[model samples]
Target: MTIANWCVLAACLLPTATVGLAKLASARLPSGGGRYNNKQPREWAAGLSGWQARANAAQMNGFESLPLFIAAVVLAQQAHADQARVDLLALGFIGLRLAYIGLYLANVDALRTVVWFAGVVVAIALLAMG
Candidate 1:
């Protein structure tokens, strides 16, 4: 498979991993089926906390990056760009995104921003290479 293809696969998997983390975090929160209620039951596991937001941010970041990744891959394939570089960029982008997620979960906003920008730069580089 092409490097672009591998990146796409990794991108897809990242969300699942984030979701698993979110679910685990959510499980710690109080269980409730009520809508628009913000009460921490005795069993509540700190819902809507920063950690949850970070997981959500990671999911959102994944979604935002997906289209760009796809576009880069398609453009690279069409333009016959260097597969190795594209693949390397793709891996780099994924790694940066993962780091961004970690930083976000840890509430490290500045570092998360840096990682987010790095991912964006990687995508732009891939697009430019195309």
Candidate 2:
């Protein structure tokens, strides 16, 4: 498989990784009552705050961003865009996404937004490459 194909898989997994942070934060709460409730995950997530809240928000954003990124990558491949450039941009998107999640968890809203914008740009660039 192409590197970009692997990146598409990674992008698909990103939200799960982000939400895992929220779950980890929740699990580490002082109270034993903070255990993850798989029965009602959204309700459990709704009560998250601080970095946990940001993690959940990042998870949502990851999901929201997937359609565009996936479509762009697939379309780019179908259109026979340069494979090396597509793979590089795919890596860029993943890198920016990782940075965005880190910045969100660190409570650096402004910089996180900038990274998020850069990721979007990368996705758009992938689409344009098609």
Candidate 3:
């Protein structure tokens, strides 16, 4: 598979990893006070606070971003855009997304927004490259 294809996979997995971080946090809680609820996972996630809440939000954002990124990459490839450039842009998107997630978890809202915008721009660039 091409590097862009791998990036697509990475983008797809990012949300799961982010949500896992939240679940991991719940595992650290005492006496099951805020433990993950398998039967009502959405409710459990909705009740999260602090860093855990931020992690869940990041996960949702990751999912929200995936469609555009995936389409851009696929369209770029199908249109026979330069492979190296496509790969570079895909890598950049992944990097920016990782930074955004970290910033969200760290409670750095301003920087996170900036990074999120950067990632979206990169994905759009990929689309235009096609």
Candidate 4:
């Protein structure tokens, strides 16, 4: 596979890793429904609740972004678009997604949202370029 394809695959795996980490952390939390609901759990629950939204968001973003990533590759291949641009955009999307996940996990909403939007914009740009 191409570098772009590899980057896309890595991007796809990132959310899954986030969810697994969140769940592992959640499993260590003290038992309480409220603990799960809140963003900051007092203990290990903090990892669970604090990262839950971010993990979910990452998963959502992954689902939303995958199609565009794939489309970019296909279009670049079929339409004879610039391979370097496609690869760079794919890498940028992955980087933004990783940043989004980290910021989300840290409970940095504003910055995380910005990074998320950046990824979305990258994906949209790729699709439009098609």
lDDT for each residue of candidate 3 in 27-83, tens digit (9 for 90 to 100): 877745889978889889888999989999999999999999999999999999999
Q: Roughly what TM-score does model 4 have, to 2 decimal places?
A: 0.74
The TM-score values for the models, in the order shown, are 0.80, 0.94, 0.96, 0.74
The lDDT values for all models are 0.74, 0.91, 0.93, 0.72
Q: Write the per-residue lDDT of candidate 4 for residues 20-116, one digit (tens) a residue.
A: 6666655655666433434453443334444675676666667777777777667765676677887888889888988887887788889888897
Model 2 Cα lDDT, one tens digit per residue, 70-125: 99999999999999999999999999999998998899999888899999999999
Q: What is the C-alpha RMSD, rounded to one decimal, of candidate 3?
A: 1.0
Q: Which number leads on TM-score?
A: 3
Report the alpha-carbon TM-score of model 3 versus the true structure.
0.96
Select the stronger candidate by lDDT from 2 and 3.
3
lDDT of 4 at 3: 70
Question: How are the candidates ranked when ordered by lDDT, highest leading?
Answer: 3, 2, 1, 4
Q: Which stretches of candidate 4 lie over 4 Å from their true place?
A: 27-48
Error of 4 at 44 (Å): 15
Give the least accurate 10-residue stretch of model 1, judged by summed lDDT: 34-43
Return whichever of 1 and 2 wins on TM-score. 2
